[model samples]
Target: MSGLNDRILGLGLLVLAVAYGWVAQQWPEPFGGSEGLGPETFPTILSVVLVIGSLYLMVKPDADAQWPWGKTALELLVAVIVLVIYALLLEPLGFVISTTLVVGTLSWRMGASPGKAFLTGLISAVVVFGLFNYGLSLSLPAGLLEIN
Candidate 1:
């Protein structure tokens, strides 16, 4: 049963990887972006890694693996929901706000105090926004944070 469970999960992840990779490829090329790496590069790389990992899981299912139950499973489900919501909210809330919500919620779930978790989220969001918007010379959608 455990091996079967692993195989099922691996198959699901494989499908997700393929879909993600395809979506990544659909992104329009950035105008005058870096010569070699474009907006899709990181997601493409992640999907590739997911593909490899999923394939390995499918081929080498752990016989003793036990699926999480009760609280653990619920927590995992919440995390997934948060990520999906984050994607939906990104363009409307802006990267900073959306990332802050996602990170803070996840951190709180992992036992961080609410204030600390949100602070961490804010700091991380700002730093990452700066890194990508400045250091990497890539533009993240500013959305509501856009300054005229």
Candidate 2:
């Protein structure tokens, strides 16, 4: 049963990699002589890596492996919920508030203390905002917050 599951997962990963690689290769490059690497370059590389990793796993899967399906499913569900909430709140509440809320919620769900979660989330949001919006000069929506 475990072997069967490993094979299925490996095959699925291979299929996903092939699809991603195909899509990356098919994407049209800008008309002007190609810049550094196109958007597809990273995805193409990642797809190749995924394929290789899946092949390796197929060949020599760990014998002691136990699928924690229930725990994994719960975690995945929580993560999806966190992402959805973050996306929904991004435009309205702004990066800091939305990111903090999502991160804090996720941390709490994952069994962190509320105070620790809030501190970590706030720091993460601020750091990310600083990197993307200030340092990188990308214009993220300020939303309800007054842009300083």
Candidate 3:
């Protein structure tokens, strides 16, 4: 049963990796022609790694694996739901707000106090947002907090 579960998960991840790689390849060439490290490079690399890892899982699953039940399973389900909702709200709430909420929820689930979790989320969101926007010269959607 565990082997079957691993194979099924591997197959699903393999499909996702292929689709992600394909989408990465579909990006248009940058102006002044394709050059070093375009937008697709990182995702394409990650998808390739995912493909390899998934294939390995399919080939060699863990011998002693157990599926979660009861509270643990419920917690996993809650995490997934939170992540999905975070994705849905990211564009509307913006990266900082959405990330803060998601991180705070996940951190609290992992045993941190609610206040500390939210503060951590806020700090992390700001740092990463700064890194991407200023250091990397990429813009995340400002959404409701748009300055202009």
Give me the candidate number with maximum lDDT.
1
Better of 2 and 3 by TM-score: 3
**lDDT tens digits, residues 13-42, model 1?**
999999999999999878765457777887
Best by TM-score: 3
What would the TM-score be for candidate 3 when compared with the true structure? Answer: 0.89
Clashes of each: 0, 0, 0
Please identify model 1 stretches exceeding 4 Å from their true place.
Answer: 32-34
- lDDT for residue 41 in candidate 3, whole number 0-100: 77
Off by over 4 Å in 2: 69-73, 80-104, 115-148
What lDDT would each prediction earn against the true structure?
Answer: 0.92, 0.83, 0.91
| Cα lDDT, model 2, residue 53 | 88
Q: Per-residue lDDT of 47-147 in model 2, one digit per residue for the tens?
A: 99999988977886776677568988889888998898789889999988888888888897788999999888999988998876766555566777856
1 versus 3: better lDDT goes to: 1
TM-score of 2: 0.61
Write the residue-wise lDDT of candidate 3 on 1-148 in tens digits.
Answer: 6588889889999999999999999999887896776778778999999999999999999867899999999999999999999999999999999999999999999899999999999999989989878865567877778887
Q: In candidate 2, where is summed lDDT lowest over 10 consecutive residues?
A: 132-141
- Alpha carbon lDDT of residue 11, candidate 2? 87
Clashing pairs in 3: none
